[model samples]
Target: MADDASFPAGSEILLLEDDLPLRKRLAAHLRLHGAEVTEALRLEEARRLLRDLRFDFAVVDLHLPDGEVLDLLREGAFSENTGVVVMTAFGGVKQAVEAMRLGAGDYLTKPFEPDQLGVAFSRCRWNRRATRRDEHRSAEPGAGAEELFFGQSLAAVRTQLDTIIAAERRLERRLPPVLIEGETGTGKSALARWLHQNGPRADRPFVSVNCAALPDTLAESELFGHERGAFTDAKRARIGLFEAADGGTLFLDEIASLSPGTQAKVLTAIEEGTIRRLGGTREVQVDARVVTASNRPLDDLVAQGSFREDLYHRLNLLRVVLAPLRDRGTDILPLAHHLLARIAARHRLRGLTITRDGEARLLAQTWRGNVRELAHEIERAVIFSPGPELDFATLGGAPIPSAGNWRNPAWRLPESGFSLETAVNEFIADALRETGNNVSAAARRLGVTREFLRYRLSGAKEPSAPPDANHPGG
Candidate 1:
């Protein structure tokens, strides 16, 4: 396998196994398969290798000399590109489940055939390559910036854009305090910028302050101007973000992270449209629109008593919920192309394109890190992609399944034998894979209509397949 020209040339892999014979055999096998293999006898060595080198995949023994393989998975030592396959002599259903939950790409029992390892490697490699291609496609030039959201579903896109646009328009009227809620990397800041740019106060300054980044002691002075000599370090009178954004817009990012006292000041400013500088008795009337963003639901925070209900209601006047990347399938491709073009232009590199397989991979995964993850992946691909075409093998990991990992045989199948429902689901999955997950194509190939295929897909009584190999769609 080491001398096989068909295998990926120069790809690096990390093999973590305490068994010396097994380690050597795997290393030789991978090297023969055209991969550069690094061996680790202990978990510490594995960690050191991960820190020092970028590996495309890792074959880990469930138990190590110093620790368990699950630790590495939990710690995210492997970049999203690194595929992890856990093998153990004592492998059981429980161990596999635990490993999968920790993000292992696949699980193999001890004494398995070397060919099985090869298959796992090949599958992961292919998945990574497909992901890279999608990332390249997403960063293409002149693509709308809206691709920051994932998804290809037209309804999803329209609904999100409508909410964004509506919020923007509403913010123009009274500059009512606005709140945005979504998971991390869901483009909350981007939406905030859009509101600032499109709102009535577009010409005014757009000031942003991250509540989480500021010290609680400085937050008050940061939001409201501080007079000289107000504090020990006060050297000169300083205008706060609210004052700076007067006649403009103030974006408060990570508002949920603000301290209670700071939240009180914020509430006061929003309610009165006036701020009193620290050490100054007089109030400074400021006309600024406030846009606050939080990763958590403000209602939930309010209920938990971490966030103030009054403040929540004030900011919630014009609320917009940014959908997670997984929900915006329609935007995935466009975003990927847009990001690629921007990256290529920024780096002065030749343009890159995505293949059909690449598109399919992009649309198939759940984007937990949302647009930011997609952006990083695309940027990395632009740096490593050979020539003008982005290949799928470079992506480095399988697409996370959108429906979650309910399909693993250990989890979904009955012990005695395959259930009738599971059999039907397996058949449909095979058909879908064969047709590259194109509903119409799969339906035609399977001698069924597209609608029928959709029905079966939605109603199938089996665990959903994992996303089509963690391609760079999101």
Candidate 2:
């Protein structure tokens, strides 16, 4: 298995190529780079090796003597942890996409340089880790469905994050650790992901874990790693989060839960750029950017002696805070609408909306769970809504009666201005459709006279007042 980060050095690799001279040269190159290479000249020989031994990575040609490599890919011949890089002379966009979709980590058009092979293997490693991360996220409940939404109220926080990303790009190596503090369910994990996706290593892996979820006995082994026979039930050696996230970001949510002993090791890893696996003699180097989040303020934890003061100071250098949802008064409605849209689309529902009363009910809540609570409320409303309007009957209050007034005092114009004319037209059109194009009914629904509605529908200039107060259906 490959313990070293980035390249394939100090790992086992399988080199599969049909051409004799090319195979020998490639094997020698990989071996020179400190990798243990096993060479196979045919598909049958490769299959035999694969069945008999476990390899960390495989560099295989597309067309083998006995069969095509796609056969093996479709059959899932490679282990889940084995990173595979395919080389082909007849490579195209479609072929590459197909190969990756099947199971291959990376695709390469052949007649390439030896250096490119190393780079491809590096990409393969990242791709494999990323795929595993995505699969794990998908398997968890309510994961990947919560999109990051930073509305007008979060504008300053967004600006600060952008500044941090800019600073990160300018530095060549060793990105500084970032600390995110917020209440539970305030989207701290989402924010960490946003930072990683927008930073210099967007193409690299982003590994995430909840420190609070790790049991006390396994915390150190999970974060650092464990060698075979390190403890009871230690079946095999494994790479930890730091090594898996090499050259990218590692997000630790609820980091305050780590024990003092584990915290010291984390600090050492961050400061010294190395970690020693449990029951292992040599220290392995890792360069994963650590981004940690805490539900409670670390300052309080440090004061109580629950957290290490030195580690707190180190992470406090680059910090961003997320305000609770209740404090973001103006952001409630827009955020609810965004959540509504996503929930509706996922259930194959359309034209879903929040009534004025529903909007009022949403704004009145304390939102103790922040964005997470809001999302659940929206999903519940979608499930119970009898029509297009979400009245939020689950909110436990009688619906507020409409006063036939369209102008809402609570509605504030967004920082980015909108097209008033287009908005008005869309509202009128929607009313007309609901009323079966009955002009009088649409006018009544809009709290306007029939004459005014017809005038606007004709695309005429705004009338100073009603043309005829006594007009029919006025």
Candidate 3:
């Protein structure tokens, strides 16, 4: 069949099909329409090509001589800059369902029209390009940080920011104790710093301490200072963090970790505005604003009799709850791009960008670790990225099974004579099947090295092969 003449020119394609005649025909048709085509007869060859070159989209056959195209799908091989269209001659409802579950961008039955393939590829490319543009704009500093934090959601982050700003304006006399609650790595510390810098105490010192890090025995002296010879290590008088932060702000991270004795001292200091040095009679007044943060709900801790009720009420005056990254879906792409730019700048690279595939992979992840994990991943990608633009390979691979699937398998395990090795092998095989034999994606889902997977595959008897006509490689 003739290719679609209306298809855009110069699109790059990675074509994987073992059948020489079909591969040749598709390449010729695509080339006639001004596309650059790379052909691979084997899944391994396609993976190698993908590692070295970036493609606008990929066309993968469902079955291969040695394995299934689903293996490639599982590996997230097309996760970077390419959209994928899976073709199957032996296609069944089960196979199509599994292919889509494994992250196939599009699936087609055999004997499909060339024009249909062109349209699918074009749609994927267009969407990816548009997403990249949107990410770039949002990642630019000051373009969407406010919108990122406030406008996109009905979450109280906007009101919280406004409250913080108002608190800063009123910081000269007395600033209420500010309590921030969030899961770890949700930018609680960053928000605290922003409040500190933007508030009236901007000129004063902003001291921070992790209450959880203080030794139970030394917590009192750490926060209220100690006179010489007060304890075994008290060789001389030393100023506590509270005294050091006078006229500024004191951020106590993980405040819920404090011991009951320490909590009492902290409550006293907050209420009385005075703390006496250990072994000293004189009470020194402290004038620092207090900002406390905890990863868990302090009220829950109070209910459990772990955290002090009085301290909880005292710190709850101006509360701000930072949303976890996964909960803030609108911010994911923007954050990814922002982190990419920051990583690029830090690495001294110019005009670094995320490819459409890269952004899609980023969006596909659950980001259980939140912004911190995303930032770390981007930093790694920047270091390993081959070109100015981050590609699919840089993403390490698309997450094989969606988090939900991996957490809750739709299928049941075999009941009889189950062995750990057998179970593992079965799981790997199922994952490969689900992902259309995508190795990288299988590895990701299995949480093992691709090399390890290769080793395991080599030891096992060859899996049942699909028909050879449309299968890519043997």
Candidate 4:
């Protein structure tokens, strides 16, 4: 009887419908069920109420006189606690999919039951409440603080951040698990933490596990815990990361490396919210939000049979792809500055500023290591810079020409002043001539990947002017 719950007591609901009679009946039903109801007849009125109050629930009619209600989901007008239930008389499966993708918690057709309205909010609140309770029972204590952050950069990077922020605003019932894909050192783990901190369960614990770092022999026990004497080394009963993170978030970084056995077990926990400790008899239920990050393509891995398709489906509900630093356009210098300041503060050194030349060098180069590499460079620069200003040398390595110069030969500049990529390509071509087109000797002489050189030679983009402070991006 208790499991067949109706709604959370005193839950604040925003009900928007053009049909006044139907809206009133829905409001009356919700009010009678002990929910605080706010009614709006027009989209504009709903927009106004959303701006002023934080509601626990939102029941929106899809077609309004002004426009479709999908805009509200796109704009994130409602708070994160609001589980948007889109009701429509005209729309079908396509509309429902669109609503779900845009962050609706539930979708309903016209002539649906008031009790079915109750059903829409059930899984989310129940899981959320259960998670909260689990947090109280966690054996390991949680840190009471959370870090807050917002990121900005040039156009490409800016677009990426905007997409991430939009996804963060969605208040789905179960808080759809996120799959973050990016190159190594591109801040995949950092982005995962940001999502957890900004989400509805922010106040709860955030547990991070580096799947790649865990050894195959012990990863299962480490993740799912082990009862005393469950394995050769099990001396006492233990709690797994999932239980520790109940009611909060579990960030699995480098998740693509998880072995098949571990992957299967993790999928079970995600799908059923339950896990059995290694050597334990009973299954323990957990309610931790899952966020996974991978440096490689999980799809390719799945196709290769290295990963489970079912697990990938469960984890890839919402996606955030972090761009490599080199592709981020004009955001390079601003990020460098931010990193420099933080690095200086952390090291107890005087704040350091990047010189103009330093900025140019920073903007240039293939940052194969991405943001993490950049941070290390900044830290190194801080350690050696005598004055408050940092030069290119302090950042380490000679200033390399950007990919732009190689990709485009028409961009005008002094003879040798701006010919890094062009010069490198020319030298390689000349080497081929000098060696009579011997690719093996060319590769050996150049000490570079033959594939790498070939890619550059064939895949160069249209030439563009050097990056200017006025125009920045990857």
Candidate 5:
């Protein structure tokens, strides 16, 4: 028997091939790897199995006894969650492309080794994950794109994650749930993904969902799945994230936002290793490792009676708390540079560097939004700067002044005082010049209205009253 590490126990697979010898060989290989293989030698048999069962993956031959597998593909016989690998005797670019267009995750030509099935299955899993991720991003625009950066400040976090990964390797099944607590924009989702990718089940699907974004009415169905007639709009049966992430990790971001009832269901799923669909009576056993994250601490939510204490305790078994960005001052500079490099590559820019003053400004601000905010700041500078060095474009308010300049807050007035009007005019002019003389852009850089900027540029005599930078017609 092959090592069971390749497939989780109870992993369901539908194998369709006309050649009895090849079908038996593939089925034997899959069974040895811990998958429960449902063999079908004809298209009709495959169709019947697909109609009655939900498979994690499907291996289909292009030409079958009754019909071409492409016919089933065209009819959408497989769910979006099912990873399909199409095998063909006649290898052609057109056939491969058509299979892929019809939702095949991978294409394999004939005369391949049985060992190669593992690689093909891995690729199929990746394709399924990518498709789901793209669908999620489409629903939630402006999702975080910041890469995970573990620096000195995050050493503790890294160590804890390493320990968890080590533990996962030692276990054969049902990895314990992980709880990640952090402030918003602290890269909780990214951390969860990193844990999944580094864990023993890296080859399995990594499913992610934002509980906070799920409507209260549909939260249960979304997490546990639903039957065809589960609800008003549940026109068809659908496997939820738990089943989609079977034998892998399911990341639930902002888990505290789920209603008490849904929280109870989640707790049950964790404890029993099974979930009953919203309208389902039969409890479907699943082996997904749940990794939940919350911007607000679950302890607080439990205390407030908004979350279930039992669920909190269950997930609290393996917990890691991420420090806020303001508390991790040492990581600011290095993380910024890391993000800058990625952003520059994405924009196809060359030789982009943050100026010394820009570094000072980045370090000065208390990043309330954490790494996500830092990435945006760097991206803004990259997009707006015309030179090789970034000027921060207005990221940290006004520019830093020289040691002896009047702009310094600690600077005391000399025996000969400076003109207040001259100082304000110079400030406005500097903003205009920095933004390439665009009034609107300059106004934004100065945190003022365009009207205020225009009025300041008019060179009018100073009014007795203070100027209102926010006024519409300043």
Candidate 6:
């Protein structure tokens, strides 16, 4: 398995291609990039390789002699973490869409260059690797669901929540689909869980799905049941999440990440109160209340055509927006103490308190990760504390940007307003300088993708800042 933070290096790869020339070229390219390549010319050979060797990733040509390469995906031939990418000479929208629905991590058209292959490989390489176990461990029902501590800023939202509760009481059979929008780590999941525990369906089932972490393949069938023979490897008719959460609530977190196909199915299910198993024709009515949460704006996504407008409207029927921790001014210290008490109790400590310096640090710091980050920091402090008091000195710190250029520290405004593009260029240059001209390290600091950084660099005017071994990630 690959590390939590690096690319797929020294990982075993299974390459299946009927075109011998293409297969040989791709295998060599992968090996050159630090992969152990296992080549296969036919479906049978690929099956034998899959059976015999453990692989980190599989590159398969959709048009295999024995059958569709999708069969290998369906047959449970690859481990859960072993990502797969599909390639085809006869590429079309239908094929690509089908590949996505079938759970391939990425897709590529034929006659592509080694660079294109690497792009596809990269997609499957750094894909989010959180499993259901990690989900359960991270989202443990922290504190009680009944207790909600909100500052004065949340008065309006509190009223909205009360309205939801009232509506839930009146609507005996079904509830309106609720949507919660907030930044990451702003307690969206916790709020969703709270609603499930407090609502009329308190005794019923509650299913939570992290949309960002869902595998690309089998997403639709997983949400809306699937029949036995829905595809190659679905041996038994399985109840989808909707069915599993029947007469209860289904919470979908980071809902913006859902694909267009999955989004359509979800919209249909919500509007019609019916779900058809992937291969089955019969429509089964489900009484599950969908409460989706997104860290991004769904309206923007809808306008951009990435998200369906109908789905967005449906989800917005009952919407709640959560304020980020930074904006929740008075709640900072109290929230810190609340978390500290829980951590101390769990660790069997007599008493724990945050010192004055710790409180100031919490208030002054820009919590990029929000409440989730605070919780983790508090836990670390409790575990490693030599004594009871938690001091800010023990926690590490980073450089703070000046006030005038908080977002862009090194850039300054001249007497004449500078162009926005020029400002961005200078910011990139400053980042490179700070990191000593290392683009990857600078990208990490900038919180942008390497591709984004490189695009910025490439777009710069004449005298292009050439980046190679000397300026990495540039």
Query: Top TM-score: which candidate number?
Result: 2
Predictions in order: lDDT: 0.70, 0.80, 0.71, 0.71, 0.79, 0.73
Candidate 3 residue spans exceeding 4 A from truth: 1-151, 392-474
Q: What does candidate 4 score on TM?
A: 0.53
Error of 4 at 27 (Å): 42
RMSD, one per candidate, in order: 30.2, 11.1, 35.7, 19.7, 13.6, 26.8
lDDT of 5 at 452: 60
Model 5, 277-355: lDDT tens digits are: 7666566777889999999988988889888899999999999998877777547889989999999999999899988
C-alpha TM-score for every candidate: 0.53, 0.64, 0.52, 0.53, 0.62, 0.54
- lDDT string for model 3 (13-92, tens) is 88999999998988888888878899988988988887666565788887777688778777766543357778888536
lDDT of 5: 0.79
Per-residue lDDT of model 6, residues 189-296, tens digit only: 888888888788887667788788777687776687565567998765555777656667788888888898889889888888888777765566667889999998
- Residue 180, model 6, lDDT: 96
89 Cα displacement, candidate 5 (Å) = 17
lDDT of 2 by residue, 1-474 (tens): 122234544768899998888888888888888888999878888888877776778888888779988888787677554678888886464766677788787877878777677777767766655554565456444534236788887888899999999999998368889999999989998999899888998777778888998998998887887766679977655667787787788899999999999999999889998888776666667788999999999999999999999999999999999988887766899999988888889999989989877887777678889998989989988887789899786876434436554444335565466688888899899789978999998877777778788889888876896555445564
Q: Rank the candidates by lDDT, best first.
A: 2, 5, 6, 4, 3, 1
What shift in Å separates residue 440 of candidate 4 from its native position after superposition?
Answer: 50
Pairs clashing within candidate 6? 103-217
Candidate with top lDDT is 2
Worst 10 residues of 4 by lDDT: 465-474
Looking at candidate 3, what is the lDDT of residue 35?
82
Q: State the number of backbone clashes in model 6.
A: 1
lDDT of model number 2 = 0.80
Better of 1 and 6 by lDDT: 6
